[model samples]
Target: MTDHAGTAATTLGISTAGLDLEASVALAAEADAAGVHAIWTSELYSMSATVSLAAMATGTRRCRLGSSILYGVGRTPLVLAAEARSLDKLSGGRLVLGLGNGTVRMLRDWHGTDPSAPAARMEELVTVVRKLWRIHEGRVHHDGHFYHVDITPTGDVRPPLRECIPVYLAGVNPRMIEVAGRVADGLVGHPLFTLRYLDEVVRPAITKGAGRMGRRAENIRITTMVIAAVDEDEEQARRDAASQIAFYASVKTYDRALAVAGFAAEARAIREAFARGDLEAMTAAVPDRMIDAIAVAGTPRQVRDALRRYEGTVDHVILYAPTLGLAAPRADRNVRRLVAIATAPRDGAR
Candidate 1:
């Protein structure tokens, strides 16, 4: 609590994963009351991020609200723009519209959409959303390679609460991170990201893309998820965190996260085990070194120390509770522990 990290003031957030709708909203309210910097929701197969945030918007007055990611091709640009506008107004303009393109298999199988050029599709999608939000007149139309739109309102369209709502792009790879720099207000990094990767690869890509648009790199904020599995039983916490790391490592979509951190061999091990559907072996593949580098797990003191390592690399670090093997009660307990870790007293109190 005494600026042990000694870098900058930390802004902490919590993601409501592995929670039911009612429980997630309650957590949001609790996080808001506890003065967490932000409250984020990740969109998986269920639980609409926008919908959950809408309910959270009603209960929260202080915490900034967003999705860690809302998939790009899941909805049309107009629909996305409309949802952002609605949520922005609901939260009194505190919305950070975080978007992502689902993995190739997910895109094709789940959403029935093609993933031929996801980065390009995402860039175009952002462009269209911005243009649509700013348009106040009768006719609205866009003919893009991936999306097409033409709409003429019978009456004047209601002006958005803010013409420029902050859009945060989710990036695990350079191309997506670059798109974020070119257009997004912020970039959301994966839980597996390391400080070295952020400095050496992520930030530079942002600069390159920002340069293309004649914009400064520093203007784009960075928010990241830090998987935090807290339990008084230290061994249990480590196992839970490792399970999460193993699951992510198995996915080829997140290969860059491991590759950039020189965890390629470990990832291969996890992948092979994943193919055989051997959960235990996959979990076993994640070493303690990997856990220490990417997540915060163990006793309260140890978790806090691990979090300090991320202070300077991220503007907001969302405490991601590992849920692959956690029961509801234990997961909720971890969330509360995270809240305590985040709001603990620091020397540079402000």
Candidate 2:
């Protein structure tokens, strides 16, 4: 087990917004040079993560690049494996493949794919991708309902890269965590996780899943995502954070996570108020306690203190900076501030 307290080691990562691919690549290179450990690209309504990562791989020399959470059903497992292998080779084996079963809106409405039986589909996808990576020359066979692959490549389709590309599964549900424990190298906890849920629910479930494979809990790297906003004016920062929280809270997936975090009463009230167009109640429901439970908001010093509160609990804290309303210069400054605090010597070690 790696000691969480040693050196206060932390990985500084960022999820790029809807920006030009070329600009994003340059920003990634700049971030890498600024001592950022990893860079994660998302496949939202914009460019695909693979394409963005490919560009980033060419732009940066040392930083690890990966998809924050690529949908498992978004692409074929074989193709996904091939792309990951290719990116690994391109980036000199600094590629981490992060996979997850995305939201129903993305799967069904946007991508026009079936969302029924997602667990079965994800299981099959993980199996097929691993088989594709491990096997050399054979027709992979799976008797699963969602996936059945039996094709062999004529040429050299094997992943020649020797470095282990860590697969991090983004999961909040128990079954999904079990899948992660059984197959994935790491688990990315949801953004809505609270300290209580982490101790009582999430950690226990992860342990149970890992125990099934005769593996210790410490072997699995757990990365928790936290929405963060830092500014001199604390009230403005809280208001900014509330808008972002409201957006995710309205989503069913995150709403469930919030409820699990002991916010069921508040969540219900917020939902009811929102339905009735009560903006005041909606904003009021997102109190400082709720924001502090799942997010880090305040000045730079305060943000750093809040992060250190989870020092012994989580392995890595991926801070999601607010880039929605702020200008490029301001947002970049905030990002630099966060990176500085996150990578600084802990407890006045310096």
For each candidate, give its TM-score against the true structure. 0.94, 0.89
Distance (Å) between predicted and true CA of 15, model 2? 2.7
lDDT of 2 by residue, 223-331 (tens): 7777778888877667766766765676667766787777887787777877887766676788788988988888887887887766767766677776655677766
Worst lDDT 10-window in candidate 2 = 1-10
> In lDDT terms, which candidate is top?
1
Candidate 1: which pairs clash? 1-346
Writing each residue's lDDT as its tens digit, candidate 1 over 1-350 gives 11112246657888987787898899999888888878888778877888898999999998889898888788989889989989999999888899988688988998988868888899999999988887675577899898888877776679999869889898888998999989988888888898878888889999999899998787788888889999999999999999999988888888877888889999999999999989999999999899888889999988987877766556778899998977788888998888787777654533
Report, for all candidates in order, the number of backbone clashes: 1, 0
RMSDs, each prediction? 2.8, 2.7
**Looking at candidate 1, what is the lDDT of residue 80?**
92
Cα-lDDT of candidate 2: 0.73
